[model samples]
Target: MKASALWPMIIILTLIITACSNNDEASEEVDEEDLEETTEITAFMPEHDEMNFEENSFTKLMEDEYNIDFEFETTSWDGTAANERRQISLASGDYPDVYYLIPWVDQFSPSDLIRYGKQGVLLPLNDLIEEHAPNLQAVLDEDEEFRAMATAPDGNIYGVPQLVECFHCTWGNKMWLNTSWLDELDLETPETHEEFKETLMAFRDEDPNGNGEQDEIPLSGSTMTQKESIIPFLMNGFIYDDLETRLLIEDGKVDFAANKEEWRDGLEYIRSLYDEGLIDPGAFTQNADAYMQLGNEEPNILGAAPAVHIQLFTDNDNQYDFDALAPLEGPNAAYSSYTHPIEQGATFALTNKASSAAQIKSIQVLDYMFTEEGSLRAFFGEEGEGWKKPEEGDVAINEDVEPIYVDIPEGEDETLRNDNWAASAQYYHPVEFRDGIVQVEDIYTEEGFERRLQEATYLYEDQEPEDVFPYWGVWYGEDVQDEIAELETNILDNVDQSAVRFITGDLSLEDDWDDYIAGLESLGVERYVEINQDAYDKYLENVE
Candidate 1:
């Protein structure tokens, strides 16, 4: 061979040697111990538009800890069109491996969960929780009521429900009176129906706003939320108005309150208020935005408003003037509406398409979120940047549980905070856990938000009657689920329309009362009662 041929061979050999050396060096750079084999999981979640899940601290922490990469499908926080999207995904059979939802937004109702679970579209979590999720299992072991609510009639937990034991949320339909107006008029908080009536009358008559004009609303409510509606609080003073079920359990039997004479008397009382222009005319149809405008606008046009929390309608300086009104004594009865404190329906679930490994990873991530450290991080954000550990002498809402941390910037925008998970994950903060946390010292600051709420809610707590219905935890069996749903839809619609008609004088309460009762009976109110009674009995039996 010539020297030129030898030169070409030598060049090729040197290039090959260099390539091999570089490859070996690259291989050596990877540390076996540090290498993580990540599993990719797809999830559909509900989120506020401001939240960026990719940059969320909770998501980052979970991904890092579990060695899993997440592909997220996030919908608007309000979830207005999210359900339609979810349904389409379900129908297309292109659903993600997991769903992380906020119940108030788009989430699986118990009926939906049961149906999808039975169809094998959702995976049962009982065995998975036991095998892979010790934290969730521990929660179940500690709270039997939670386990009962989570379990289906078929004896399987198809989805994970959020156990938010919010103390203030249980009796969310209390009224708030502007004490400044009352004091200016030399009136005390009304305790009786007649006294309350007189007070509203005075508010309407007197120019309480000091504008020297009849701009004061006197008494107002919105149809926005049950808490904002005046009917639940006022009507409850007349009968056991379980706001959710709209049916009360009396003498261990289910009874429809809307058709009862007490309910009629309550309507008549409310009608009198409407007739005299005490309640806001727009309260019957206006949304939260309009209702909030009544309280939040300058010059303070509202005299009194019905709400679970004043924050629902007003915030900042506008909220300070209001205080919770005690349940009024009515002709028939006097009681505040009570609710059991468990958010029903499924907030998180694994789809059938998830592989066994993916399922394990999913459960592990959720379990971590349920932990004390993880719960705080998931909700408030990372300790130092998002919040700070409590120092000595810091006061807690309750002294029984040790103080955890106080918020730093306090009330920063969700977009700027690490607590992007919000209600998307399982965050269990029982009364003790919550009360033990350091509260904001300043009532006006963002850190003081929870404390202020706690103080205001304290006045309304324990006002529930002994026999308030536990509708929050009940699940209608599969046999009557569809029927119950249909009946409720029709009955509630009829009742709501009739209530408005009676109040606004669209229908004569005296003349239309019998027809209204008849209408309900025609709509199968009897069967509705029977079905619920059966469910209630079954619920009691199971819980007992």
Candidate 2:
């Protein structure tokens, strides 16, 4: 009886233990399934040739790590059409849950953020960022300019702005001279306004290209943007031509640069060049394609062209022949147009349509981009495929900085790797991170173009006026935004048109100078300055 009882008791105890173990295993399986649950987010972004979000390595990694699924609605990288599509989506109330934009391609302007934020179309990101984005918050806390640019007048963050501290981009208006031609003619790089003029004369008179056709364009530019304009590079020698703003700050007071006597003098100098046929008449009227044609012509007819980089004007074959010209010194000043590297627009935004879970996950995804590891992966792609750790003897772009990463060049046969998001994922890239990229020792090659730009930028660095206005951080109140925008358009247009007319002899500088000044006054130039001054004051308060 004792043996049978002991056997029955032992069997019952063993069954109970096995049941408990099975229950524990079932609980573990349920927990694993819960962990695998994913949040779905719909995003609107621009389509890029280098990336397919569906197959992107970074995208897949984010999906697995954050337990999120991304569905994208993309427009082509054509800026105008992309902007139109984004606006149409907003207008039709068919917008996506989130908008992941590329700053260069298209993004919401400050005014657009204000409008949509107030309308409740774009969700306020202040609470989300504070709670879910420690990396982004650290940046906002440290960089005053970034904080100012990201925050609206109402002290609410509607979106996350991209902070790419690109060194070469700061000095956008640069004059790229044909150094090959200079060497051929045995001339030195121009250092002063007079020397620059003399150099252009030689380019016009001498056969520097050696084709002997006398078809050389001594100096040329385009009407595409201020960076392409021949006027800013030359005008900066006489007056601080900030190009787009035409605003100058002196003794903390805002004034117009285009209305000064120095501006008239600059026009006279340009007029002399036009009269002598040294200045290309096409420069004042040609678009970028037409302007590029002058540079890409056989035997390289262009002696000098105004652009941010040589690649903008000439293809790779002729890019090496040109080099950046330092800001020319004039009687009044020597200045280069400087735009802060932090872009003005917001690149990532969450709309009201997104679910709460989606918003949190989306922000978490963006927050990762602010970290060094995440930034490299999101921007450059997976390790060894898009980029790799720097090898021995590899030099960083900034010589002082230690090398962190080197890009893997794409094979000639492969057009698109579909590996990284390209520029769309650029949420945070500070100076140290950008400068830490490895570069080849030979800076003249295509792969070392970044180094070339870096060296060129050094020449123009610190050339801007000490008290130059910070345009990127300013935010106008809704009440004055439209008024100032209107005034800006009218005033800038008149200034551009009148300057061309004066230089081309369509309007005599002696006779039409007063009329041009009067025209600016008629266009509410004073009012524009007053509003900008107010904005600047407010911007100072916000940043400081």
The per-prediction CA RMSD against the true structure, in angstroms, equals: 12.8, 14.8
Cand. 2 TM to true fold:
0.92
The digit string of per-residue lDDT tens for model 2 on 230-330 reads 99999988999887789999998999899999999999988888898988989988987887777889888898899888888887477788989999999
TM-score of every model versus the real structure: 0.89, 0.92
lDDT (Cα atoms) of all candidates against the true structure: 0.79, 0.86
In the range 110-188, model 1's lDDT, one tens digit per residue, is 8987877776677789988998899899989888788878888788898888877776777788788888888889998
Runs with alpha carbons beyond 4 Å of true place in candidate 2: 1-36
Candidate 1: C-alpha RMSD to true structure equals 12.8
Which candidate number maximizes TM-score? 2
lDDT of 2: 0.86
